[model samples]
Target: MTEASMRFEEGEGFARRMDAEDPLRSFREEFLFPQSPQGEPLVYLAGNSLGLQPRRAQQYVQEEMEDWARLGVEGHFHARRPWLPYHENLTGQTARLVGALPLEVVVMNTLSVNLHLMMVSFYRPTRERFKILIEGGAFPSDQYAVASQARFHGFDPKDAVLKLEPRAGEDTLRTEDILETLERHGSEIALVLLGNVNYLTGQAFDMKALTQAAHARGCRVGFDLAHGAGNLRLSLHDDGPDFAVWCSYKYLNGGPGALGGVFIHERHARAEGLPRFEGWWGNDKAIRFQMGPDFVPLPGAEGWQLSNPPIFQLAALRASMELFDRATMPSLRGKGDRLTGYLEFLLDRLPSGFVRITTPRDVKARGSQLSLRFSKDPRRLLTRLSEAGVCCDFRSPDIIRAAPAPLYNSFQDVYRFVKVLESHARD
Candidate 1:
């Protein structure tokens, strides 16, 4: 059916029909869904926060653990999937997920750590072009990271960090305003660092346009793709962003606090003296064990690795990346668009004046999440919904964020969640 003819009827029948027709419906069975007291799967719409664990996750971790116990030291090379090159296995899949070449991507430290490392290389500043431009209300961790980087470079956060804010009475930032800001201050701005998908508003920025505009003004650019990496179809390399960093836990389904992925555009891959913090793992694999005094860095993003990663974390991530490889990002994204559109259709029809969606109306401008702004406290409403077996999450004073993740969520799940919210609005 055409999107315009996709009229949503007021019943479970339409939802069921949509699910029955979905091509990716079987993918839901691959995950371990959490259940309420009645042993039924709750309407899980919080994959934006923590994805449901993949069924194969435990098995993958156990293989590594068993190898560690049996072979001990020899496991580094003798394990079922040898530990020395375990992270290398994830490089290609992760690169595919973020739309970059394998050489430009690497699985490494947590999100913020990678952000700081990227900043070390991309955020180089001079006395004139040292200002950092970023979106206002960025994730707190990113704000902290930018500020600390500025301070470490002998600049005050107040003077060095430039935050782009929304206009009064606006819920989200406008693209034109972003470009204008880049154009207006491009000469003095040393770096442009913004969240590709804003966590609070679910806004997906036009990274290509932003990157091109920044490059035009001689400013280096990067992105925090925490919410964009798996949630949206990205071309991090082709889009010409200098660097990008993201966590795999949210949309990548890599379990809580999983390893993050980084992209250092191939343009910076060489040994042409790019300044970065290095350790043993960042050294060239050929001479890494020789314990030489010289630090011979590896090519591309691997040169940024500080130490070997935690094995269990990589194992949990491997299980999910394998699933993504089979399902494919384009297919998952197709489903995500329809699933979120269904949620938006239902929410728009509600008679309640108590809340409004803060997420953008244009589907292309957002991701899988829909952020709702309530006139009153949304926490109580969220609590009541949870009691009724819903699993969406509440953010701060009034926003409730629901994400109908394409990999596992179904149309029926969206219907059930809205039904609960409609009931609360009536009360």
Candidate 2:
């Protein structure tokens, strides 16, 4: 049902009815949830930070362990699924997941590593245009990576890096402001890198418009899809960003520390002069074993690989991607919008002045996450939530983030979470 037509009501029975009518309800059983000391299932709403483990992950990982035990060295070529080309198995699903052609996507190193690799090629700064543009409150790791990149290029970060901040009294950036900034500083910007979805406010940016604006200014554009990958319906090829990167651990439901994926537009698939840090795994398959001194990079995103990927990580991610492939992005995104909308509706019913939602109220402008900003210190409330078996997370200062992941979260879960908030309001 569309969000506008979906009627919401107060009471536990309404939540149960919504769950009963949900088309995706059965998918909930696919994951394993954590339990409280009393053997009750914890209300898990932290999928934005780390997704719950898929039940199939263990089975997929166990299969690889068996192959390693049975075939030893020969497992590279002879074992089921094989070891040498294990990363290849994830390519098609990875591509489909992010709306890119298979040649444009590759599953490889962790997020920050892939970001640096993409910068090696896309962030080609010159004497005239040598600045990088990013959000002011980007995840700390991104801040460090871009700043270090500026220093490596012999420019002072304080001068070379430009951070975009929201207008006074606002909690999120406006699309018009972002476009205007790009137009004003277009000449000086060598690269425009942004998180497609802000990790803090859960604001989804207009990547298509941002990419067009940056490209018009002769600047290379990239996105960290760390929060956007599975949470949003992305069309990287259509959006026309030079490159993008994301970790599989969140939303994609891969286990913690799982490998990340990268996307390089097909235009750069075989660009001969593009600068990249080459390694053995990125070498063209035909002559890779020749042990030649010269690096012959493979075509497309695979050309960016630095080494053979970790097999166990790939196997675990493969299991989760399989579910995503079956569920499809369109279906998941539709349900996600509804789930988050329902969460917003329920949260609005809490006592006035109890807490404020920092996430944009526009359903299309956010994913399943909502950031709750409170007037008082929230650490004690967070402790109380844990004690009550609620599984949301607290950011520093006064914000708490709760993500009702549609893949597994039920309407009842949202209802129950708000009930706890109502209790806190009374207290």
Model 2 local distance difference test score = 0.91
| Tens digit of per-residue lDDT, candidate 1, span 36-132 | 7668988888889999999999999999999999999899999999999999999989989999999999999999999999998888888898899
RMSD of each: 1.2, 1.0
lDDT of 2 by residue, 1-427 (tens): 7665678888999889889988889889999999966588889999999999999999999999999999998888987999999998989999999999999999999999999999999988899999999999999999999999999999999999999999999999999999999989999999999999999999999999999999999999999999999899999999999999999999998889989999999999999999999999999999999999999999999999989889999999998898888889888888888778888888888888889999998877888899999765588888778888889978889999999888889988988888988888878
Predicted structure with the largest lDDT when compared to the true one? 2
Q: Give candidate 1 misplaced runs (Cα > 4 Å).
A: 1-5
The TM-score of predicted model 1 comes to 0.98
Which residue pairs show backbone clashes in model 2?
none
Q: What's each prediction's clash count?
A: 0, 0
Give the runs in model 2 whose Cα sits over 4 Å from its true position: none
Ten-residue stretch with the least lDDT total in model 2: 1-10
Question: Model 2, 92: alpha-carbon shift in Å?
Answer: 1.1
